[model samples]
Target chain A: MKELERVGLPTVHVCTIVPISQTVGANRIVPSVAIPHPLGDPTKPLEEEKAIRRRLLLKALEALQADIEEQTIFGN
Target chain B: MTYRVVHYINQFFAGIGGEERADYPPELREGVVGPGQALQAALGEEAVVVATLVCGDDYFAEHAEEAVDKIIGLLESYRPDALVAGPAFNAGRYGMACGALCDAVSKKLCIPVVTAMYPENPAVEIYRKDLYIVETSDSARGMRDAIPKMARLILKQLNGEPLGRPEEEGYIERGIRVNIFRDRIGAERAVDMLIKKLKGEDFATEYPMPSFDRVPPAPAIQNIREAKIALVTSGGIVPKGNPDRIEASSATKYGEYSIAGLENLTPETHETVHGGYDPTYANDDPDRVLPLDVARELEKEGAFGSLHDKYYATVGNGTPVAYAKKFGEEIAKKLKEADVDGVILTST
Candidate 1:
């Protein structure tokens, strides 16, 4: 992701483990769900799960459009 | 007689409890525990797991130094030839404990140690440069493959054998620039690489360019009074005498201190232990770096609902990025658990 960003490509490093990604120096971040299934949890109902996935995808798009300087974290 | 080795595992693997029991503290027991049993079997007659150390993820995060010290004392009494930590897979805290302990064991006890975890296990980034970490699948489904690989690497370390490339050995890259005497010398190697690059036929570069990765910045808080804010810093401020002994530089640990009843930081009560810069000013007025005094005043003025009683501190100078990330995650979780709605991170 860093290499991709370095070449003037807009990138958002998406993951459930924000701290780990930040430690690796990931520039743009979008916090997803937990590690196992990054977008949604199985414990949630099918519709709710879909909603979770949809929400994350929206956030990833939001992150790409956002501008940042220095170490910054995106997503709730 | 077999190679005596100590095993480390977390509470969940030990069958003690799950998240509810995550504050179970540290304990030492005879014989192998959950994952250790598999490790012992893989080790075969060449090695024996003499004892197992179990710790809760929360407990270790809360009291790292004390827990590590206690575990080390237990390990010293056993006098094991080597230490083997988990095939922790994707488990974050377990992987961290294993990585931190293995690193400590290697440095303090002067012994070889090995741990297995998923490549993204967080600990890999922190301790990999100082230890050998076998790469494994993200879940325990990869156990059968991981055990053998970890055992092979640990045995190699025990016997002081030479290791091949990371791909060849199934271990993650440690990012250390090793000086090896090449068969053809630097000029020949350079020419060979140049020709291969010009050919553009599956050429591999010996050096890769470095890139910096940063975050996009989380959204700012909307309401002040409704938001509970926690304070975090890499400024190395602590109670007088530096109780946690966080290193002046190259810190491996962090401290969480409560400011529940305190309104301002006094010179006699707090001081800066960081060695990278002048500490006189920070010592004279600890708030200059930590900003507890201003934070309290801001709270009274309703800039935020309430300040978290506890503030997390760790020395940033010379600290590895991995450790810094670990501290941040753990402290963030603690603050979140305390119902903190926002965080105020101050750095020196």
Candidate 2:
């Protein structure tokens, strides 16, 4: 992804862990969900889980398209 | 019998244009093109160039999963006996692409694959262990020598020949620990190495430390209301009884506790298990350190969408960075699944 971004393509990485993402030098990241279950909250109701996942996916799309000068953390 | 081979190269080598065209997606052409011609000539008649796949550096980087999947599909159709990626020299992205593609070909296609790049190219760090990554000069000027070396290595793999050491084969060492018998004993080798070092002569260390990859932060949040925030701490705050019994120092595990029903954390309900600092202040009102009080106020005011029902806790003090990394990964995956948008991380 670094190679792709270096060549002027937009990229976004979504992670539940911030430090690991930062350590890896990911310049565009959106923090969402958790590690074991990144897209859904198993404890939540089905509709709620779907809504939660949808919000994160939307955020990720925005993050991928945004321009960044340095490593920045994105959150809701 | 002629062996079918697929040649992989970057946009620059394909003459699709330079970095300006680096965003170009992967495309396949029947038979040789651009540098493929030179590569084909070097292969002789025993090998026949079957196809060439060209992708822009930026394109592959941004769409790695898709790019590799697409490339894999293209190659499966050709059913090539061997895969040859670029002698990428010192071009960072090109080197990465070649190394990554070759790795995929070797793993997924289960075919013999070969590539060449400068030893310094960052790709060598990740992909060298897969197979033959011949050493090349830093630019296209060394293309002459790089071609045949890669060709020879792949041909050897095809012939099922026993391989020699990297030094003899003109490839970089993968730094794997192989227990080959040596002429000198451990004590003697250590003494010999010490003398060489004292004399300022070159002597490679038996074990080289691995370097970590550094990454920049992601873009900042643009909208607060649309965000779903969460709280996380390395300050060792947990339920008063500490159900998980996480250690005070060098903690081996982390805890995820629900903050779903709380307006504020009470002294009776929460306390610190961290061994590095005084617990008096944090124990007085757990909210001071964990900040559930402040977060609740914001949640009521609609400062952000909503707080994640759970927050993670662990002790940062005295924990190994490696352990910390593992915890971070696991926690992040959980938070990601929960659809958290941002986090408020506190450290003592």
Candidate 3:
């Protein structure tokens, strides 16, 4: 991500709930609820999971399109 | 025989007051405050807390240079042999203030500085290298243990003795790199390790692992509506039946699947065979792993010019750093060819 960013390509990261990426310097991050299933709760109904995934994904896309000067957190 | 020491504390710890007193500018007072007594007691007769300075967290953060200058001015008169700040524990702002102070003191005064905080504190990365940082619990409950370690490190600096590793000294790992002479070759050690592995014998690793220095975040994209965005992942989602046959683990290759006019990813058309873990969820409905449904929705919302017709995928677990870099560059080239202005990379 850093390399791509250096070359002038915009990049937003979708990461797990873990805080590791925040420390490693990902400026735009959207936190997935868990490690194995980042977009939705695996235990929920398939349709319900799909709804959650769509919301988070839209937020992530919005984050990429938005202008930011410093590190920004998107959907938590 | 006495070694003079300088103590740094926030307004609350300095005994000036609480949140209301947080604006208390940097003031130097002779003698110790609360924890300074415990620190002095631990330092014994060899070290004395000669001067103490207190400032508010908000004030210091808002006026870092002014605070540092004021504190440095006060320290010039005392010239302590060492500086010790907070065992800030879980207080984010206080921990950061202590780190900032330690870094400033070491750079300006050219004296050893030490402090302690929990590993989770955000300040660990800020000043771990500028000073000796002893690891402490989330609260002051471990002060008895943390202070003794700080005192020992301070004493070592005063006596010019070699400082040991964090594990040996019971301090927090400062994440500083130092070269040390080793007794044997890593290859030979690896062979021996392999032999031990075959024999199931316990053996120490010859080459210790290095720490990771994370890069700072990059600036965000300016225009989503005008930008052509691409989707990338290490989740290993690919065309049905794994057409590209990308490896499930330690992948040496990556695959890109087209979604030119696709509104959703059905299991019949897309599936994930990543071997890192069970792919039951991803295989049932590829949209669970790849957000094509959402991407199409956003496209309708005019959030971007268009999601790239194709999205890139790879299995990241255990993939060598070199290969991962190569794969990223290759995929980036593809995206560039398609005039992608930005990327949203999903990691699983």
* Chain A vs native chain A, TM-score per candidate: 0.90, 0.85, 0.88
lDDT of 1 at A14: 51
Q: How do the candidates rank by lDDT, highest first?
A: 3, 2, 1
What is each predicted model's overall lDDT from 0 to 1? 0.75, 0.77, 0.80
Clashes of 3: 2
Best by DockQ: 3
Instruction: List per-candidate RMSD values in Å.
Output: 16.1, 13.7, 14.2
Q: Give each model a TM-score.
A: 0.50, 0.51, 0.52
**Maximum-lDDT candidate:** 3
What tens digits encode model 2's per-residue C-alpha lDDT throughout B29-102? 99998878888888888798999999999999988889999999988889899999998899888888898898
lDDT of 3 by residue, B82-201 (tens): 999888887888888889888888898889888889988899867765667888999978888888988998899889999997777776666666787779977887898999988999
RMSD of 2: 13.7
lDDT of 1 by residue, B108-209 (tens): 999889888898888887888888899999998998988888888888888889988887899888887777676797788788888887888566667764
Regions of candidate 2 where Cα sits further than 4 Å from its true position: A1-76, B119-122, B211-348
Off by over 4 Å in 1: A1-76, B180-203, B214-348
CAPRI-style class, candidate 1: incorrect
Worst 10 residues of 2 chain B by lDDT: B211-220
What value of lDDT does candidate 1 attain over all alpha carbons?
0.75
**Model 1 chain B worst lDDT run, 10 consecutive residues:** B211-220
